[model samples]
Target: MNEMHHRMARTCMVYTSAALLALLPVTACGDATEDVPTKTVDTSALQPGSYPTEPRNVADRKPANAASIREAIRLAESMPLAMEVDKQYVYNQSSSGKIYAPELPPQQGDSVWVENFGAVIPGLVVGWTSNAQQREDFALGRNIDQTVLRFSNPDQAKHAAKVLSEDNRKDSPAKRDVRIPGHDAAISYVTEQDSVVTWMPHDDLLIYTFVTPGLEVPPDVDYVIGMTKTALDKNIEMLAGYQRTPTDEMPDLAIDTDGLLGRTLPVDDMNKSGATEGVYSPHAALHLRGRADVLKRAFDDAGVDLVADAGARVYRSSDSAAAYRLVAALIDQLDPRYETTDAPAGMPEAKCFKKSDRRSSRFTSIPQFQCLFTNGRYVAVVDAAQIQDLHQKASAQYLLLTDER
Candidate 1:
């Protein structure tokens, strides 16, 4: 028999043995049974085709304000992608629908509005923020944070825009009123360090944009103001396409209409505080990724429209071919600290990587091992501390995807 056949035979033997089963770690292994009697398997009858290639159906659950959350997610898709503001704004830090308090610019005073603004901004239904920077090093590149706040009516939104802008101005004597060209209704100001803050009301939404220059760059009021305008214009144009859920119907907005979240691995409660567990549109997902600019191109090329995040991340592409392209793109974009490694046993299509050194960075966490695998139109990524654990997770994820019931 060939070397490939020999390897498969060995893997089958190990999988079928009760001894190895007992040695396996207590990790997620889909449908893995315990305390099974050892059995002799006919290796000659086994083929690579035995592996699963399709995703199994999973049940969906709804949470409170599920419909409103779903609408916010759709609104996020309409938010200007960082690249649209500027190609250099490539590193997206955060994007979500859970905006409560305004994230003001640096050096801005701690206003009472920062703490009790929610009480004043009535009819606040939902909000989204798309924050990005030119580089991972915050001290070395420009940054832009665009926020969209939705209210029950246009009047309430208009009031919010005015109150938020005035509160910031009143809290800081260093804040000087500024005018944005061609935007008479825009409330803008230049604060210390030359950062620009602008608030504009559009229909039933309040659009807020903040821009800051790199520390090394000299403070240029015009440049910051220009960037603020650009961000506002992009946001306005993108939001024009958004169709908000009617105020009365927001409470009944359905969640997971596409069922992407149901198939994703659920997040651990222990890690819930730090994890963003939900289904997101492609642009919204970019805000949660590293090297988002590069991923945007890959996503566009692969026709990736939906992404689900929890314990593991799942990306839905247009087809098997597109999924493969996305996998390749992801592998190619790995940080320099990682190196390619062997895939899970008997799973040739899966790609795995291991960190090569203990390089520390305040901005990012480096996982010890990461594995990416695909099932039909879906691609999933899982991280683990050990190669063995990674393999087990990959195996379980594969089975989970293939499980039809």
Candidate 2:
């Protein structure tokens, strides 16, 4: 297999096992029969069983919705998530409301669950199942992750970084050799089962995993992962993810060393810099950022909020940069219940705003971008049109208004 595939496989194996181990007790409940058998089974010793496809009873299944998404994830999270037997029923819900059965159905229904343990090297996915109910535990393609956006939370990547750091201190090998495919070397760490982990690699952040098994990772997952392979790609991807590409040609400016003290990137100049629009719509970014207050002002000021802020910070004096940094620092402040990370592969908390038609800031949601200010600070912006049913021409004013000396 390719490097990324190998890395992903290995990394997934380690973390998946760890995560499964973590959830074992929770899924066991208090019932003695519910306890997971610790018996090891050699995968080679067991014969592969043929799985009969189970017919989908769409009528019995719950219709997909925000609530259903929640329940699916909850069920996946709470199960004694381990593959114990060589054979089991692997059921999946089709887009057309049919349940596709696994090649082998070990067991069925709510009593059955998947596991990740196998004999002889203990391969990746192992679990159990039964066939009475239609609730697909690991249904892919559902918008379950969308539900996670609610309830102010910490970025999973940052949490991974912290875990890596701690593991490094303890001399963990996983921390030293983790890589992010073609992107950068990552400091891989474990997270709750079926979650993502990340790390910082210089100016660019590299995320290692987004563990959503049995679910098709949103196209964005591959898009983000593939594009983040290079520094140029990362810069453009970050901007594009926010839908803020420069519409015009390049700009010319001089090196401003004074603006970049103790900051993330300290470039010599931005002369002859080009511009391009984001891959996603500004409106999409607003919804993704998901902060009502910041969303309001950012969407209104879509075009300039992120770019202008970055430009200004790129040109700001030291005092201004320092002050802005202080505020920027608070963007991803941690919560006792909402643990976040500040290291590589993680995003920091940020104050956000939206733009009005007149270049003034307002409360709206839609156009979104991250502000990199002249004072060396970062803020977030969202699209206005997405905030409501209203639609208007969102003219992002400058390709790059440079200081032409």
**In terms of TM-score, which candidate is strongest?**
1
Clashes of 1: 1
Error of 2 at 307 (Å): 16
| Every candidate's lDDT | 0.62, 0.22
Q: What TM-score does prediction 2 earn?
A: 0.20
Error of 2 at 376 (Å): 37
Candidate 2: how many backbone clashes?
A: 76
lDDT of 2 by residue, 1-405 (tens): 222332232222211000000000112124333222233222233221221112222223322221222222222222211110101211211111101112121111111112310121111111111111012233322111110111012243234344434433332223123345754444433322322233443221212222232244433444333322332233224323321112121111111122221221211232212110111122222222122223223233222222111111221212322323323332332111222212111112223333334432211222332222221122222122232211111111111111220
The worst-scoring run of ten residues by lDDT in candidate 2 lies at 15-24
Residue-level lDDT of model 1, residues 163-183, one tens digit each, is: 877666644433588988867
